[model samples]
Target: MTSPITTLTLDGLETVYDRLAQAIDRAGEDKRALFLVKLALLNAQALGDAELFQQQMEKALLNL
Candidate 1:
């Protein structure tokens, strides 16, 4: 069975956004894409649901 996704609080989201921005900066322009792909793959593996990950990816693509 698929587990319900946990929603992050506003404060938690802000913290994560800040950390992600910092990490992207550290990854540098030359390798930021690679860094993000690696991060996404790791997160997807942890999530343990490829279908859910694909759905999330689709949601993320909206309004971008």
Candidate 2:
């Protein structure tokens, strides 16, 4: 039920995230934590719902 562009974007993001994760690992845990916070802030900004996105981000962090 997804558009081609959406699917492509998701796949591309996944690949980029994989690489980011690898680089963060090499850089150390501090960088990794910063990367996660950056992702959360980006998500909230992009979604236009800072409160809701933040709650979800907290849940994800807890689960992680």
Candidate 3:
């Protein structure tokens, strides 16, 4: 079965965006990539759906 799409409200999105930016800054220039990979892996594990994660990865790659 496909996972349901979840949408964050504007406030929630802003909160998340702010926190993520803070986290990346805290990770510093050298460790930022590693930190992001670790974060993505942890989130994917929590999500428990490989196909959904793959789809999300594809979406994230768009226009970049």
Candidate 4:
């Protein structure tokens, strides 16, 4: 019983993860870590996982 928007968001997240992985491979470890943090946040928001979202935000801040 997933909505169209939800389905689209999941697909978008997959695409974003793929692109981020490629970018990380081309760049450096730090950049890859940052992208991963971002991906986690986006995933949390999309799935209404507030605890994960906050944890990811904290991790991202620590990285910065």
Whose lDDT is greatest here? 1
Candidate 4 lDDT over residue span 1-64, tens digit each: 3323333488898997798678779767767777766766677767676765587578868946
The CA lDDT at 23 in model 2 is: 74
Q: What clash pairs does model 4 have?
A: none
- In order of listing, the candidates' clash counts read 0, 0, 0, 0
Model 3 over residues 1-64: C-alpha lDDT tens digits?
5456688999999999999999999999999999999999999987889988999999999999
* Candidate 4 worst ten-residue window by lDDT: 1-10
TM accuracy, model 1: 0.92
4, model 2: CA deviation in Å? 18
Q: Model 1 misses residue 10 by how many Å?
A: 0.5
Worst 10 residues of 1 by lDDT: 1-10
What TM-scores do the predictions have?
A: 0.92, 0.46, 0.89, 0.39
Q: How many clashing residue pairs, candidate 4?
A: 0
Question: How do these models rank on lDDT, best leading?
Answer: 1, 3, 2, 4
Cα lDDT over the full model 1: 0.96
Candidate 2 wrongly placed segments (more than 4 Å): 1-27, 61-64
Q: How does each model score on lDDT?
A: 0.96, 0.69, 0.94, 0.69
Candidate with more favorable, higher TM-score: 2 or 3: 3
Question: How much is 30 displaced in model 4, in angstroms?
Answer: 2.8
